[model samples]
Target: MGRKVALGGILTAISIIFLYLAVYLPSAKLTMYFLTGIIPGFILVEMGARQAWLLYFATSMLSFLVLGNLVNAVPYIFIFGIYPLIKYYIEKTRNILIELTLKLLFFNIASLAVYFIWTRVFLINITIAFPIVWLVLGLQFAFLVYDYVFTRVIFYYWDKIRVYWRKDVR
Candidate 1:
């Protein structure tokens, strides 16, 4: 129990640092934000969905406070941080069609929410020229690639380091 708490705390700190880096370093915002997503994946793999969610809530709330701009953290909190658990359940379903369908549905909903926040709340002139359909399709493709990469990363960690780490996780 103590070990889980310590690990969760550590991952939460790392996630917060990533959020801060994204907020402070404009040049590296994309990279830092994407990197932040990986922390939740690690937690999901190491602890479980419940612990991963705890970390997600902690990171998301802390990110909003640190960012001082809800728009900036919406992508992380809604899409990135939660992807791993979604992936876990999708994979467990063992139905490629259902997995693909659910994955696309989730991505579309999240993408629309992000889009709505950016355009409506932040008033970022993004969809002025580009059609909303195009934007959503692009996001869907990107999410597909992201999902593939996430699976590959999980495989790599599972074979290389997860065994050793799990020994101390409980």
Candidate 2:
């Protein structure tokens, strides 16, 4: 338990630092922008999807008061239109990659579309909205990559933890 707490703190530090790197990304390379913001999201999903969403909401509430940024509602945790599609594929006994791919697709394609439409209708200046949208999307995608990689590796250990045993210590 202590080790997990320490690890969580370390990951949060790394994520905050990477999010700080958002300034380095150029307009044309919006993907990088999304990747940085998603670092924390990735860590959240790794711990627990539902709990991750709660953590995301907490961070988002803070972000709003600090920066007045409303992009936090992009629904990164729940993944719009993705769960159903992935479920369809899973029912067919498809590979895990397919599910991850759908997660990416939902965030990159559907959620972004929703965000863009919302920002366009509400925000007066679409120009200012573009960069923010790009960054949010970039973060979502990056988190997906990290989540997929970490999730697979964690599963490996989780599987082993059940069977591994210590010997000669009696």
Maximum-lDDT candidate: 1
Residues 39-123, model 1: lDDT tens digits: 8888887888999989999998888777766677888977888888787888898999999999999888887888888888889
The 10-residue segment with the lowest total lDDT in model 2? 76-85
- Candidates' TM-scores? 0.88, 0.40
Error of 1 at 106 (Å): 0.4
Predictions: Cα RMSD each: 2.3, 8.4
Candidate 2 lDDT tens digits, 75-152: 322342123223334435566777666656655666557556567845534445567778876777775765565456
Off by over 4 Å in 1: 128-133, 166-170
| Each prediction's number of clashing residue pairs | 0, 4
